[model samples]
Target: MRLLAAVDLGEGLESVVESARFLQEGLSIPAELLHVVPTPYFEALGRRFPHLRPGLEEALSQVEKEVQKTLADTGLRARVLRGFPAQVVAGEALKSRLVLLGQRGTGTLEALARGGLARYLLHRGEVPVLLLPRALKAVRRIAVGLDDSPASLSAFRVAEAWGRALGAEVFGLHLVSGQGGCCFPTYLDPETLGLADVLARAKAHLESLLKATGVVEVSKGDEELDLLRLAKAREADLLVLGSKAKSTWRHRLGRMVEVLSSQSSMPLLVVPEATVW
Candidate 1:
């Protein structure tokens, strides 16, 4: 599959380079890089400065140089474009199998790559977008949220493949909630799975899913927050989940993925069931 990576040369440029390299080796795919120049803004400045063209060209040239230098001998084809960063990147991402970007921490303007652009793309079903952290290393452990739905099942397949490819451990996370505000218990077993038929089915499904997917560890959480806590405690390098669902109400799960992507420090990989992977 072709990978499209945006090189902003911003706060997380180094991490982006590393992420691209990781994908290159793991996915064994060709990568095409694009660096966007704020053309409209520069044009407005040129109207007044009368000498902005040289600096603009230099800025574009510098980004090209940095991307090439950092990805030396990696065979990553790259190009420089002029437009709003988000718009340009999203338009190109429409044709890619995956998109990778380095997301920054809490900051006003600096968070554009993750804040504005990220949220927009996360809502779109074009392709899977992998958001990398500002600091990164080789991926070793991957945690994937799971449910009985086909979407979750599809995500698990993709996550498991990545785990095997990277020689990483894969963990399956399932959340259980019941009436009377009951959530996942601190301890779990067949009894904890509950005596109800539905609960038994859920527990059975989870067990079967994890086993079939070759997930090394299985954990149950009461809520999404608990999953995040377990992920952090487990020192997982990446988290994966389905991007959307079939039902209207269930589609809200993607919102949870969006929230996890923004709050978690680790990279979040959302796999789409509709994707032709």
Candidate 2:
């Protein structure tokens, strides 16, 4: 599959390159290194700091050149593009099977805050997007966070497909956060059903849904430290999540998809809730 690695010339460019290299080595997908120039205001800032601007641009350009050289050295193909980051990335993403992006910044505070390129691609990209974290060690297995929702099923499908392609194991994790205390009310108590029963049903549902894919290993867990922790414990190379647009700001903010994106170390594969089979 053709993997488009979005090399946003942000602070995360180095991490993006590492991720692209990892994907190329692990999955053997042809990768294209893409860069997006900043808008006019940022361009003016660059002009003000001429030395710094040239140095930074040179570093970024070197990254592109290095990636191209590496691909060529390995007998793989690569492409480089420059334009508005989001727009250019979106355009290239359309031509690729999957789009890869790195989490915005290196600082912990910046990662905690919103508005990063990784988060933007997760929320906005039309194709399946993978948000690579700065600390990704290797890609051995993929973990999929599953619920009884259609979006979750879609996420499972994507993860399974990717795992199959890479000859990697797939861990299907279904997390159930017990009633009350920070979780939404609807998720509380399982509506007269026993917690064990609810979990069992969820596991059964995942089994049935994934029966045809044979490559996935399904399991259930309690939602405690978020899906990120579970993935970390499993040493997952990727985490699959699902998102649905919500009206309430709190709901949107507390969304599992966003929560996973903000905190997870493994790359995330997000599929829209309304995505059709």
Candidate 3:
């Protein structure tokens, strides 16, 4: 089980490296650092004007050297490749247990326009992807969304494993919809007898699914907001969620995954559909 840390020539490079270190130590897995020099623009320009090929090659070489220097003495295996960044990473992910990426925290339009790696991998990649914000340095607490699906179960297992490894508190959150609308009665509201029954069922289900104690919590309301609120209440530093698979792109990413991907303030770890333990 190897972890692949994808780095780029961005201001978040150091933070990504730090995140890699955290995972390397906590997960007890060997990590390979990769820097992919995008080739689309250079390849197109070089094809149009053959004279620029040598210059582009030299520039690429320089970038590789810079990446090597940055990774020096970091104790991580380093390699550089030239291709479309997302494609290259996805290819590498086939052999990796997890892929660590540094998100620029860009908005929806900007991310789609720039072809965000996180979003792309979340939908299509084979392995789970761990996205770290530039500001996150460590993982002390983790929050995972739970459901009966294999992907959601995989998410909880990952949360449990990482939490045990890092000695971080793990929180399991399950959100239920209200009677007719998106929102639901609070789990603690004694006035709502319906909520009491729902909360009992939710806890019992999670207990059976997780086989763990005191880590489960149930919420009723907006899926995104309730999950986020539970995470915030737990003071979690990492949020874990699972994505579902579908024939169409629109259905591949669940509404909760879509919302948290853009709105999460902490680092996000997305477990893909049909992920194996």
Ranked by TM-score from best down, the candidates are: 3, 1, 2
Provide the lDDT at 240 for model 2: 78
- Top lDDT hit: 3
State each model's CA lDDT, in order: 0.70, 0.63, 0.78
Q: Candidate 2: global Cα-lDDT?
A: 0.63
* Error at 40, model 2, angstroms: 2.2
What tens-digit string does per-residue lDDT give for candidate 1 at 77-127?
A: 777777888888889998788888777774545555457777667666567
lDDT per residue as tens, model 3, 1-277? 6899888767767777888887787789988899888889989999999999999989888978887887765677888888999899989998899988776656778556434787778878478888776645678888888766667787888778888888888878888776654434233344455776877777786778788778788777655767888887888898899878453376577777877777676788888777775
Which candidate tops TM-score? 3
Which residue pairs overlap in candidate 1's backbone? 184-222
The global Cα lDDT (0 to 1) of model 1 is 0.70
Candidates 1 and 2 compared by lDDT, better number: 1
lDDT of 2 by residue, 1-277 (tens): 4778765445666676677776676666767676554445545768888767876777767866765665445333456655566667776776776777777544668775534655555555356777776734475788877655667677777776667667888777766665553332243356687766766665665677767434333334345356677677788877877665342354542367766666665677776654432
